[model samples]
Target: MRNTAKITTAVLAAGALTLGLTACGSDNDNAGADAPLTVAATPTPQGEILTYVKDNLATKAGLELEVREFTDYVTPDTAVQQGEVDANYFQHQPYLDDFNKENGTDIVAVPDATVHLEPLGVYSHGVKKLTDLKKGATIALPNDTTNEARALKLLETNGVIKLKSGVGYEATPKDIASNPKNLQFKELEAAQLPRSLGDVDAAVINGNYALEADLSPAEDALVAESPKDNPYGNFLAVKKGDEDDPRVRKLAELLTSPEVKKFIQDKYDGAVVAAF
Candidate 1:
C-alpha cells in the first residue's frame, strides 16, 4: 500500500511539471520578439522631420526608430492601415478627412507640430505683380479641392476673383461670383503647377513641388499664403488604435522641441515655416 501511494504522488508531480512547461512555451509564443518603433513619411518635408528625430531623438528615448519613405499620397495611409508601419508623419486635416472618407479608414492624428505650410502662391512668368497681369490672363492651379480653394481664396484676396457672398472658408471655383481679370483658370496637377508657370501667365504652386522644380518660395512667389491661415499644414499620422502610444508621444515631443524649431529655421529658411 505504501509503495502504491508513493507511485501516485510521483505521477502527480510529473503531470504538474508538464503543465508548467506548456505554460512557459505558450508565453514564449505570445511574446515572440521586440520590434522597434517604425515611422513612415513622405520624401519631402515630413521625411526631413522624421530623419531629424531618428538621427537625434531615438537614442535617448530608448527606441529603434525606423523611418520608411513613400513617394505618393495613397500608400503611406494604406501602409498604416495594413499594420505595415507603426506611424507616419504626413498630410493635413482636410486631406486626411478626404482619405478616411474615401478609403473607410480610422487612422487618428497624433500630437505633432505642423511641420510646414506649403503656401499656395500665384506666380506669373511674364508679369511681376498682380496688377501687371492683363485682363483675361490665363491662370493655372492644382485641381484638388484643398489646393484649388486655397488658390481661389488667394485670388480673391488680391481682387482677382470675387467669390459668393458669405462663402468665407468653403469657397470653391464654382463660388467665384465675379472674375474681373476674366482669368481663365487651368486646373493642373499640383506637381505640374511649377511647369505650367512658363505656359500660363501665372500659376499657384505648392512649396515642396516648387522646390523640386527649382523655384524658391521666398524669391519667386508674387503672393504666398500666410503660414497662419494656410490649410496645407502637415502633422504626424498614426494608426487608429495608437494615438495614446508612448512612442508617438515621445516622437511628437521631439518634433515640437526647440532644437527642431532651430533646424527648420536653419535648413528651410522661410520656405518651410515651423508651424508648432
Candidate 2:
C-alpha cells in the first residue's frame, strides 16, 4: 500500500511538470517569429497605412500583420503596455512621453520609425480665416496635454493668440500671455473637436480626426501647422523590451520604405506627409 501511494504521488508530480512545460512552450510559440504582429492605431491615416502594408507589403516582407483601430487616444498605449497588442502607431514622442509618465507604462518608440506627420489644423465653418474670427469668439481645442499645447502654439503662430515666453509643448490656456481677440476657449476631447466646429467659432483639430471627418488639412484648414521643423511626427511604438522583435523591425522598415512615402503623397494629396 505504501509503495503504491508513493508511485501515485510521483506520477502526479511528473504530470504536473509536463503540463507546466507545455504551457511555457505554448507561450514561446505565440511569441515566435512567425506569429502575427498585432498593432493598434487610430482609424484615419494610421489604420489606413497599416492596412495598406498588411495587404500589399507584409506578405512580401515575410511578416504577418494585424491592425486594430481605436478612436480615442488612451486605449492603444494601454493595450500595448498590457500585452494585448504587439505595438501601436498613432502618437508622437511628446505625447508618448506624457502618457508613460502619467500611466506608469513602459512603452517606447522604435528607433528611426517615424512614419508620418499629420499637421494640426484649425477648421471653422463660419470663419473664412483666422483673422476673420470675431471678438469673444469661442474656439474649441483638444483637452489632452500635448495636443492642447500644440493647438495653442498653432493659434499663436497665426496671430490668433499669444502664449507666455519660452512656453513649449507643455503650454496651456493658463500660459497665455496675450489674447488679442478675447477668444473664449472651449476644451474638448481630440476626437470630438471636429463635431464642435458648429458649436464654436473655430476648432483646432488633430489631423487624423480632421481626415476622419473628410476635412482636408491642406485645403480646409484656416491655418495649418507647417511640416518643416515640426516635432510631432507620429511613429511606431512597442512595449519596452519588444523593440528587437523581428516582426517589429520588418514593420518599421516597411513603414519607412519608399513605397509608403509614395503612397502617402498619392493617397492623401498633401493631407498626410511622410516623415521617413
Candidate No. with top TM-score: 2
Model 2 ranges with Cα > 4 A deviation: 1-30
TM-scores, all candidates, are 0.80, 0.89
lDDT value, residue 165 of candidate 2? 93
RMSD of each: 15.3, 11.2
Clashing pairs in 1: none
The Cα error of candidate 1 at residue 268, in Å, is 1.2
Residue-level error in angstroms, candidate 1, position 245 = 2.0
Tens digits of per-residue lDDT, candidate 1, 187-228, equal 986767888877899998877777667677788889887887
* TM-score of decoy 1: 0.80
Per-residue alpha-carbon lDDT of candidate 2 for residues 1-276, written as tens digits (9 for 90 to 100) = 011111112333453224221111122125889877778888889999998998999999999787777788997887677665678999999999999899878889999899999999999999788888999999999999999999999999988788999998788899999998899999999989999988999999999999999999999999899999999999999888788888899999999999999999999998999997
Candidate-wise lDDT, in order: 0.70, 0.86
Clashing pairs in 2: none
